[model samples]
Target: MKYLLRYQLINYLRTYKYVPPFSIFILIMVVNYTFVPNPILNSYSFTSIMLFFLMGWFTITLFHAEDEGQKIITILHSKGQSAYYGSLFIVCIAIGFCLSMVSVIYPILIGAFGEQPRVLHIIMGFLSHFSLAVLAIALSAIFTRELVKNRQNTWWGVLSILIIAVAIVTLKSVILPVKGLIWLFPPLHLALEMMSSDDSLKNIPYVFYWQFAWIVIYSMLLIGLYFFILHHKRKL
Candidate 1:
């Protein structure tokens, strides 16, 4: 597992430095800085949006890499699918945390010269953002397999729109007594709790459950794909 993590982390780090993803991340930060002044709100929304983008990039890049060369997949099969899948999931979560932290620090540093810093709140804010970002990434990974190919970004674009629509609907519907329905949409609830004034952390359990569900489903799908590829396709 450690070897698999190291291989994936190093491979992604090497490509991340050169890809348009970094430029896109910078542009996201710039937009947040220009418009979203409150660090608390900015961090949550910025991280959510950036995660959506990065998830798509990660999925496409992984597929493109696989299609272009067999070295990584060959190594993956050698190292064992369990380790490979675990490492991929861990690496994606780590990336989410790193990106959320970067976004959080930017506004905190700028606000330091004037505003009173609520360090605990800020930390919680980043945690919330990181949680949602990872959840979104997991969802994206599940939705972007060959079953739903990129097709000129059509898959991602549609998913993005659908996610926004569901969030909006869920946000409005959560006002009633149907709080149970909120668990179905992890990112929306996380973003709401982070942005709202409540600090009791009442929603953490639901977020964890939903995110865990996503991770389980994603891992299963990937594992199934690995086996299907090896057994039938003989080379994915």
Candidate 2:
């Protein structure tokens, strides 16, 4: 597993697949913090959402860094398909968390926020960034060559899922009657909304805990579905 992870990292770096999305994400942060005194939670809300899409894009790129032949070779050497997929996911998760830290911590370190951030604010910022980031990865994991078959369609499918999943909060508000249907998609918006709460350091919101639980369960389901499709539908 360690060797496989090393190989994935080397391959990902060699392909430079991480460049586009990561570069854009960094550029966005630079531009966003160019002028200081930004609102802490509001700034976090914007970056977390941006990180969601960028990380989804990064996941697709990272997962597909190895070509078909290389993946088959790696699969044969590894324990099984699960190990292979798991390593890819671990790598993506590691990358996501690293970037999440950058998004969450960079502004804080630079003191970009107009108001002094409390412990709750920092914790919520990191949590919001991480929850949405990993959800994006899980969402993108399914729409790959091993499952989606059509290369072009995989791009569109991943993009569509990310866009719709993030936008569902707005959609849910508009279509109040059918909001329950969002259980089918990742609840990324909830993470951003969680940050919007008017909670003080003395009192944390229950919704924060509830939404995190939902994100964890939802991400696990998506990952399970990805592996299930690989086991049942991938060519041997």
* Highest TM-score scorer: 2
Cα displacement (angstroms), candidate 2, residue 57, comes to 1.2
Candidate 1, residues 1-236, lDDT tens digits: the string is 67666776777666653267667877877776665345454455545556655655664454334343554565556566445555666777677678777777776666621344465556556755565555555555545443355565646653774377336645564544676554444334544544554433433444544543453454345446544654454353
Q: lDDT score of model 1? A: 0.55
Error of 2 at 11 (Å): 1.4
Q: Where is the poorest 10-residue window by lDDT in model 2?
A: 195-204
Residue runs of model 1 more than 4 Å from their true location after superposition: 13-18, 35-39, 68-77, 112-114, 146-154, 161-166, 169-171, 174-181, 198-236
Q: Which ten residues in a row have the lowest lDDT in candidate 1?
A: 197-206
- What are the runs in model 2 whose C-alpha is more than 4 Å off? 198-202, 234-236
- Measured on C-alpha atoms, candidate 2 has an lDDT of 0.84
Q: Considering only N, C-alpha and C atoms within 3 Å, which residue pairs clash in candidate 2?
A: none
For residue 214, model 1's alpha carbon misses the true position, in angstroms, by 11
lDDT of 2 by residue, 90-121 (tens): 99889878988898889988989887788888
Give the top-scoring candidate (lDDT).
2
